[model samples]
Target: DQIILLKDGRIAETGHFEDLMAAGQTFCQLISEYAVTHRGQDGSGSSSGADSDNAETQSQDMVGSGTGGDTAAAGTTPTSRDTRAKDAKKDAKKDKKAGIIQAENILDGGLSASIFLRYLRAITYKYATLIMLFQVLMQVCYVGTSLWLKYWIGQNEDTSPESRPSLSLFLSVFSGLTLVYVLMGIVLFWVAFGVARIRASEYLHRIFMSRIMRLPPAFFDTTPLGRIINRVSSDFASIDDRIPWKLFEAIGHAVSLVASLTVVAFTTPLFLVASPFIALIYYYVQKHYQRASQAVKRICRATQSPIFQHFQETLAGVSTIRAMNLQGRFIATSAERSDLYSNSFIALAYGIRWMEILVQMVNVVITLLASLWFVLLPQGSVNAATAGLALSFAMSNSQSLIWFARTYSDLYVHMIAVERVQEYAELRTEAPLSTAPDSETGRALEHHWPQEGRI
Candidate 1:
């Protein structure tokens, strides 16, 4: 803790706090005196000569302070005394420039990709297969229910000439199967929800915390606190809610769907033939959904910045707003941001709207075409039971495809959430090391220390 307040009036070196104080680190004390003397000239830079005079006075004050530490412990002379003075002068110049050079000056872009992958891999590895499984199961239930419903309705319409409409076997089976389908869906949803909560919290929270903590202070300087808080907290929370619900739908519906389609394919291959066009239509819709989702995600992130800025400004200047009577200006600015947000949302959803319409229209076409085939075919041109069953299958498949389309649409949104999480996780970082003279000096001695360099 020994110190030398050098002749040029900057810190020389120190070993410990008490030793430095005894050695007189009175730079602060002298600066305080200079400030007191120049109190009236604070705002006005005054004369350059006055500034020079202050520096000389401060150095003179340190003359006695250096002598105390110059007498070293035992019989040693300070080894790099000349180099130390030169370096101290250079250090002061760097400090003077430091304020003007922002944290961004030293930034390296290399950290971004590494950070993004760390978060992305964590979430995907945990949820990808589980989510896919859930979707498959959900589709199965959805398709099964629709086909069974169609079969029951068609059977009722084609009642035998000799019988009254009572206790038909088709009606009985449909009713029982539909009930089971609905009940199973409810249970699957609960299961999906439980699973999602368990996994969602694990990855989401850790990634969010790690990203925020690792980000440099410069990031916070430009980025609003509210926006960062919202991204890490509210946005991720929304993603959590949206993802699990979508996943549950995809699973429960997917299972019933495959089962229902299997029952129909058993009766006729024609039903499967009709489904591909519907699948094609669905594929188109899903592509559009992905495009829209990515667009929305970009817009949402852009919107957050300005909104956060305005929000912070309003919060910080509430008194100013009131005193200046500029509430109307603030209101107008807020409205402008709101309008921007609205337009961005509308633009993002435009593709989705068209896609949904096309999907629904294609579905209707599918159903109408199936009905035409059923009605126009001669009574025995195809087996009556088989044709009837195939028509039932076609109708169910169309409905199931619509559900699948919806699930895919939801999947696109969830992927946007995933992308956002990835973006946050991939933020750039730096590991600034202290450039203290002691630490720098030790590096050269590290390998040889206490061995060849001993006594």
Candidate 2:
């Protein structure tokens, strides 16, 4: 009944095919060109005329009933294009309903204890305990080394030979403590930490894979492929490559900070007077920074999935897009998605820098307080050796504090990946592939139900 011809994204002709042909307009020109292109292969002018009549008749039938059978009988159906367009619209609606990718979740408050427990379970309690034990031993050796150095310095300053230890004895004890510290570090970092991280990675990955494989078809339908890819690729990359190191460094820095604080307190009791105030400052700074940083990181992570989803969509429709001359449009869309992710990432960077500046300022305050307390102390109340030890640890405390703050923040941020992986790992799986013979469905089947092996 009607023919609609589009030219330069606008309807150029709309009427009955016969009328459009009679008009000698855009539709007529297109038909003429198509006929000329097929004339050689079609071979007969009468056959071409028959094809044109069939096309017109099919178009009329399609306009009337919109059915496939009538169009199929015409031998060259244009209704497939309409069917495809309808399908595209339906998909667009579905995409709108389901969203291209589900938003990534950001957990509220501090990271729950369950996340840590889950990671520990992945590594197993035995390995976790062993790693902690090694860490404690390493810290003990480190403290012993510092104490021995202080003792050796005091002995050298003693004027009475009878009260002084020999240089050889000092050297032997110092070297032994240093060697033990190094050995403990090797065992903790190389053996314990490495094994634990590897086990956790393998276990989590296996669980994620198993659950994903057993997930129901509906899960995949609602969740975009790019979201799944992001989890398996970017999230797992953080778990496997980044989290372990951050966790190790965070633990190390925390332990070192504790040990240094202890040593400083032991050598200079006056420093303890300022400990509570310093701790309060640190707590507030960390709490404020962590809340902001975690939120920014979550946004950064969430925005990343759309970029992947958009890229996947673009690749999947590249051919159709090119045919429709939509390459520039797609490029612009890609840029928009990328910009969203980039903006979030930039915000995350700024948040990190803000945290770093605050942390460094706190460090400066600590160093300055320690130096003032030591210098203004009563004469002979603190020995030279003890004062020197406290000052040295105090000076080094800045690095330890900065690394502790940095690695601790990074550890929590990276744990978000593990949390995501754990979520997928615990998804409700579909029914088992095999059933027992005693079950109802299984019992109804014969041992050789299909004699010819056909369903």
Number of backbone collisions per candidate, in order?
27, 1
Off by over 4 Å in 1: 1-183, 252-282, 381-393, 396-399, 428-455
Error of 1 at 189 (Å): 2.1
Against the true structure, whose lDDT is highest? Answer: 2
The sequence of per-residue lDDT tens digits that candidate 1 reaches over residues 1-455 is 34456656655654654354334445433332343234323423644444434433443353435543232221121233223334555665688877542321112112245433443354455455555654565555555555665555656657775663455666676677667656755665555566545566577767767777878888777666666665665567656777666655665456556765676656554557777876677677777676666566556655755676688889999999999999999999988987898788777667656666776787576557656666776776665555666666656665666676667566555545555566667788655333344664343334444675545
Per-residue error at 3 for model 1, in Å? 12
Model 2 compared with the native: what TM-score? Answer: 0.74
Q: lDDT at 226 for candidate 2?
A: 86
TM-score of each: 0.59, 0.74
